[model samples]
Target: MSTALNWLSALDHPEFLADRVSAALRQWPDGDAEAVQVAEIDPAIADTSALVAATDITLESSANCLVVRARRSGTETLAAVLVLATTKADINTAIRKTLGARKCSFMSMDAAVEATGMEYGGITPIGLPQDWPLLIDERVVAQDQIVIGSGVRRSKVRMPGPLAQQLPGAQVITDLAVPIA
Candidate 1:
């Protein structure tokens, strides 16, 4: 069990996790899933700011997984961007260039939900579509533990930050985001 998540309980209710997220955790090669903990919460507090205020998790230890669209030559692709709660992904510059797209921007809630089969505000990198690139900021990977979406707004997942790199298609990129002042 992760010592950092003393504030959270073990997986009390498996139903709290999204289907894909549960599967992903169970597939962890090192049994790292055993170290993960989850907590059920009101959907209203599932968003980052409210989650921080409603629980012991701090902003620094929380990560936000966003869905962004990359478009080039009329072709559109979707990718997941994971950044620390205190930073915003540099979508227009860094991401667009990295994705080799003429345009890159956050995807609409409806599109993201339909594409990922995860509720908005709870789309985690753990269960993203394999074809969809999952970009993780260096800062987020540096955290000891991170609280992120559980694929459902009713709960959240907390795991060692580095575990994010282990996701099937995750790519650790430097300067993926800029600190929010």
Candidate 2:
């Protein structure tokens, strides 16, 4: 099976991802070689591995965007991160150090949306408020193309992996740990 979308129109509430696609296109109009397409998925496809498996795509080629909960002082913050499916964030050390917080932990769903202005399972690095901090795992760059959340859970965006690191406030590093089998 391939990742082509034969039913783009069948996507429910496409606006969730449409707005993000529109913004990304306008920003990288001269870049991204592949045409951006929205692949409709069942709402239950929330995990990266599940999305890849459903689309018959390889996990290494999928950019798994994750919402991490972090705490600074008494206030908690949600950090949006993009990494390869084969890895997991080093939350207690790397992420906390990056944020320069005495304490940091993954935020809940409600906290994620309230802080990022994107819905749960829909939050993406692109089009995030300019001030939002994004940490991208370098493993993502090793792939030719990466599939990432298109600001919605119902769909994902297929784009070049390298370009993902260029979004504003995006930092690329190998701070995350490789996922265990």
Tell me, by TM-score, which candidate is best. 1
Output the TM-score of candidate 2: 0.80
In model 1, the clashing pairs are none
State the lDDT of candidate 2 residue by residue for 1-181, as single tens digits.
5454443321333464747445655665553523444566776775676666666767777776667766767876556678877787777788788877778677787876776666677677777766667888888876777777777677666667888777877888786656747
Q: Which ten residues in a row have the lowest lDDT in candidate 1?
A: 1-10
Model 1, C-alpha of 10: deviation from truth (Å):
6.7
lDDT of each: 0.86, 0.68
Model 2 lDDT-worst window of ten: 4-13
Candidate 1 global Cα RMSD: 3.4
The global Cα lDDT (0 to 1) of model 1 is 0.86
Clashing residue pairs, backbone N/CA/C < 3 A, model 2? 69-105, 69-106, 69-107, 71-104
Candidate 2 C-alpha error for residue 116, in Å:
2.6
Tens-place lDDT per residue, model 1, 1-181, is 1113233533445687888888777677656777788887889988998878767789999999999999999999889999999998999998888899998889899999998899999999987888888889999989999999989998888889998988887999999999999
Q: Each candidate: RMSD to true structure?
A: 3.4, 3.7
